[model samples]
Target: MKIAVVGAGLGGLSFGACAARDGHEVILIDKNDEPGGVMALAREGGFSFEQGPLILTDLREDEAVGGFLASLGIHLETVRDDRGLSTPDFDLIPPEEYEGPDWRKRRLEELFPAEKKGIREYYRFYDALMEIRFLSGEKKGLLNQLRLLRAFLTVKPYENMTCRRFTEKLFSDEKLRLVFNGILADFCADADEVQCFTLPFVNTETAFDKRIPTEKKGKLYYPSYRYIVGGCQKLPEALCAYILEHNGRFLSRTVAEKVLVEAGRAVGVRLEDGREIRADMVVGCGSARDFFTELVGEEYLDGNYRRILRDFRPMEAVFMLHLGVDFDPSAFQKQSLCYYYGSYDLHGAVEKLRSGVYHRGSDGYLIYFPDRHAPAFAPPGCHCVTIYTVCPDRLREGDWESRKELFADELIRLAEEHLPGLSEHIVAKKIVTAEDYRRLTHMKKSSFGGAVPIWKQRNPPYLTPVKDLIFVGAQSESGGGVPIVLLGAVEAYEKAIRANRAEGKGPAAGPV
Candidate 1:
């Protein structure tokens, strides 16, 4: 079968790589000069920085993502990493001495003695959920099913509570509540909008401190977080190389103008240059709104798919400032990355973001030391840093390009609170706004991540109404995150193959 995948992001690349490996002709199209989409490296002066995921989970050799890459002959060196959480009055940074997995629980209990009872209760629920997650990942078996059933019964009482109610029910102190619900603002979602079960996954202790063991009693108790030794761009680069080695083609700097449909089946794609490449299957990724309305024409979509496209909310863009400094930021920030939240009002912050208000990094921002994992990202005696926050893709007051510098300066000033004398460092700086991501992702709205992950929210599905046209990526039913997208792409390809076989269609010749 010949496959034409639009948007050379991880999703498309993964799908194309799998198809090419199976002896199918693959064609990947993207507007960027290179693959990787958001995973592309941003270079300024002599410094390089990652514009996408900071730390990824489930890429270890035994994990789903790693095993998939290994099948494609792609092996990337990875290093363990963690993030720190801080507020104006307190911080949840890892201690210099290695603490156990229950460290965060103990610390929270200490800070809010009045709510110690509630904190302990929450951890019990957290541990139960973790057990369920661990078991669900295990191979199918009667024992696993029995264990999962028992685990699910333990926390069944609080399953329906929203994040807002869960936090308020657990902690009376506003500061304590933010500890769990603060991360929701990053998703551009209100605490009341997400489920209580989401609390543990987002606040995984292993993600906050690399020292926390991922295994207990010879079983994987918690998920491990890792960074590709060189950079995230390595993942896409390897996939592209694998695709090319298998006789696949990439049309970089090309725009897919439309998905050609014939007899209710997608037959090919037409490039903006008026060149049409016929394919047995067409895969669409990136910006569901753009893919359906601009490329696939809404008339071909079913009512449910169209309703999802209209109702589903994609996350807003991020404001990233990459810097190359003469001094070491690691000195002040012990960890390579730290999430400094400015406010405890997560509900208010998310509302402001969706309403086209730019917080200028005041609500929350993270400081990441890129040179820690990838030493090549900086010059000798120098280090690279990225300070960023999730903000509105389209601002209400003025455009992103016009306010880019002001927002950059504001973020720097806010970061100075964590790294003293940060402004005095002579450095190279690159400001990335929503407008830049808009052009990069080829979306007018420029949602940095996929969807907001709202509870019961409808997202674009992989199997579309149009036969032979499959969708893969963050916006798809798989949702966002590196591991999800990679595995989702493979699953989507399998689904497409199954659908083709069911329709009695055999593999076809390569596209001309």
Candidate 2:
């Protein structure tokens, strides 16, 4: 079977690699000059910076992402890593001494003496969820099922609570509540909009400190964060190389204008240059609304899919400044990446973001040192820093291109509160706004991440109503994150291959 995949992001690359490896003719189409979309590195004046987050999860050899890559004979060096969190009045920095895994709980109790009882109770709930997570990852069997059920029963009382209600129930101090819910601002979601069960996973203690043990009693307890030695681009590069080696083709710098369908089945893709490539299967990713309405035509969509496209909410964009400095920022900021939150009102911040109000990094912003991991990203005597915060794709007052520089200056000024003399040492800089992301991701309103983790929200599914046309990516049902997209794409490909076999369609020119 010949397959044409649109948008050579991680989703398309992973799917193409799988189909090509299975002896199918695979062709990947992307508008970018390179394969990886946001994973692609940005270079300015000898300084390199990744457009996405540096720390990832589940890429170890025994993990889901790593196991899949090993199957394709592709492996890259990975380093264990973690991030730091801070607020205006407090910081969650790991101590130099190796504290126990439950150190955060003890520290929180110390900081908020009045809420010590609530803190202890919250950790109990967190432990129950962690046990459920571990059991769910076990091999499927009657024993595992019963074990998972027993674990789930511990926290069953809070199953229906929203993040806001649960946090209010736990901590009386608003600052203490922000410790768990502040991360949701990155998704442009309100605490009331998300499920309480996601709080522990999103605020995983292991992610805040690398010293925390991920293995307990010879079994994986909590997931450890990791980073690709070179950068995240390595993952996409490896997948693309595998596809090419397997006799597949990548049409870079080419736009896939439309998905051609006849008699309710996708037949091929129409390129922007007025060329059409026929294929047995068509896979797509990007803005679900844009792709369905403009490329595939909404008339062909079923009522259920159309309803999801209308109701599902994708996240807003981000404002970032990548700089090359003459000093080592690590001298002041210990962690390579630190989230500096200026405000504790996460709900107000998220509302402002949705209403076209830019916080200018006052709510929260992160400063990352890419050079610490990828030393070659800067000159021998220099280092690199990326200061960024989430913002709306469109502003109510003015456009991004017109106000991006001013906003960048304001964000840098805010970051200066943490890194003294930050502006004086900058030798080079690159500012990225929502406008740049919109053009790069090919969406009118760029969603920096995928859909917000709203409870009971229905994202677009991989298997569409139209036969032979599938969807995969951050925006797909798999949701956002590096491990999720990589694993989800492979699963989608397997389903597609199975469907083809059921339809009596095998490889185009080889034995299946």
Candidate 3:
């Protein structure tokens, strides 16, 4: 069981390919010579682009990541979300076709037609508070947790509310409360501080296909949003080629640098050239307070988790730009993922992006167009596009290495008001500031998306008190994606193959 797994990211190549397909003897460390931490990649002239998480949704109805990449035989190519809807008072709002849930309640009654009875009483109070909080805390089994203890006291009135005061108390519509606060703006918190049971997974296909089940194990499906025709660096090189076809061990530019504790457990890793392997556990995949206060030395933590990794608070980060353009944003019908408001004052531009400063007259932008759903990420007629906008990871109005190209030229002058000669269709460019995501994802405030202190304050948040390290990043939980961090690295390799069958240690792989 020689695990290791430091940070090849996409939750350390999905927990080093499910703990080396569970015979365990994996490796996968990374400071990045290659690996999808932030599911990254960014070439230049011949195109490529997607420097992180660009809507690759094929989890195929929770089999999770196309049935975990067809159980690692691996199959990449996917593409959906056919464009339209460019906004700032429309450019093309005539797109609707992925019909499910009465075509998403007739596209939210055709985009808030005076809140059609407050959009059917807001999806019947968000499907009865997600069926009493998943029939009392996520459908229990194994003797139904004592018959679901009265559906966990009817989930205490939808976990005491806040999806910005329950969607602004069910509607008065400021463009549907800034389109539901831009679907929780990469969730760096706010929507009255998240937690209305995390706003019914904020439109994951209208929160599990417009629920109508109190039984049948709290049914939920959600899968339509695809694009992985090339970038997403072929998903961590297909989980590092299924952990090197199961023999595992693929270090790459090493640099783990610590975590080799002894009597107090987690026995491996210590590689900034000094090299040491050891291991029965030590997994991390990066930034759970940067390897517990810089690679395992918070003196084995436990002053209430070293004051929760020293008063954690990082949630705001994006500022990408990418571009490789000539033109082809689905030829202007646009929308290979679009959300541009320009100003509705999304919570006062998230309180002026915590003073890292980017007031594009009140910040907003999340355009993508990976050549509009993958024309192999651009070449013939060009287009990579990308673009992003959340902020504040620092740059107190100056040094993001000399003003990240003037904040990518003021977000390309607000993405040239919906690409009208978008700075004469450049041939190539790249930006990614917020101190280049805290120097390419060590993520202090480079946040990107995940960790708003487990919003509603820790439903499940433990980022290393050192039980053999552990934390699969995006600051470990709160719905970071790439199929929720590859379903949290296959549930931490099914709790490390159930603690190696309780130390007898062998034959246990259940959970393909």
Writing each residue's lDDT as its tens digit, candidate 1 over 462-494 gives 999999999999898423888888888899988
- Candidate 3, 295-391: lDDT as tens digits: 8888887787777666655577777878887766555534566666666556777777766676642456777776554566678867778778777
Candidate 2: tens digits of C-alpha lDDT, residues 269-321? 99999999998899999888988998899999999999999999999999989
- For candidate 1, which ten residues in a row score worst on lDDT? 503-512
Question: Higher lDDT: candidate 1 or 2?
Answer: 1
lDDT ranking, best first: 1, 2, 3
User: Candidate 2: which stretches are off by over 4 Å?
Assistant: 140-147, 506-512
Candidate 1: where are CA atoms >4 Å away?
Answer: 139-146, 477-479, 507-512
TM-score of each: 0.97, 0.97, 0.33
**RMSD of each candidate relative to the true structure:** 2.2, 1.7, 20.3
Worst 10 residues of 3 by lDDT: 206-215
Candidate 3 colliding pairs: 59-65, 85-92, 164-191
lDDT of each: 0.89, 0.88, 0.66
